[model samples]
Target: MVDRFVEGAEAHAMMDRLARKYLGSERFEWLMPGEERIAVIVRPTKVRHIVGVERFRPGGPVPAS
Candidate 1:
């Protein structure tokens, strides 16, 4: 999908409209470690891929990999 966008085979404007309609804000949560001192609402689906990749471990204990 990223490749498609980078190659201009995908229309980012159309994608953004669709995302807005379906997700109604693309809202999500993030929690900081220790004491609940900080939190955030993340709205970018693309960034989630990076975050997931960071948390993912190949051939490790987590099932996500």
Candidate 2:
């Protein structure tokens, strides 16, 4: 899941420190928009690769790699 929050640098710095401390180095990723916002990416514990396939193929099965 990805989420964005509108906050100033202080809030962003606080969240970044907490995230780094608790989430560790591999569980998630985040970015600061350089303004007044932050973007956080929460990934699945088990990763998957789906590079090429028809994403808009509704009701169709995903292509095997």
Q: For candidate 2, give the lDDT.
A: 0.57
Runs with alpha carbons beyond 4 Å of true place in candidate 2: 1-7, 26-65
Point to the candidate with the largest lDDT. 2
What are the lDDT figures for the candidates, one per model? 0.38, 0.57
What clash pairs does model 2 have? none
The clash count of every prediction, one per candidate, is: 0, 0
lDDT of 1 at 8: 25
Give the number of the best model, judged by TM-score: 2
Give a tens-digit lDDT track for model 1, residues 6-57: 2122333444444555555552223235322222224554543444345536
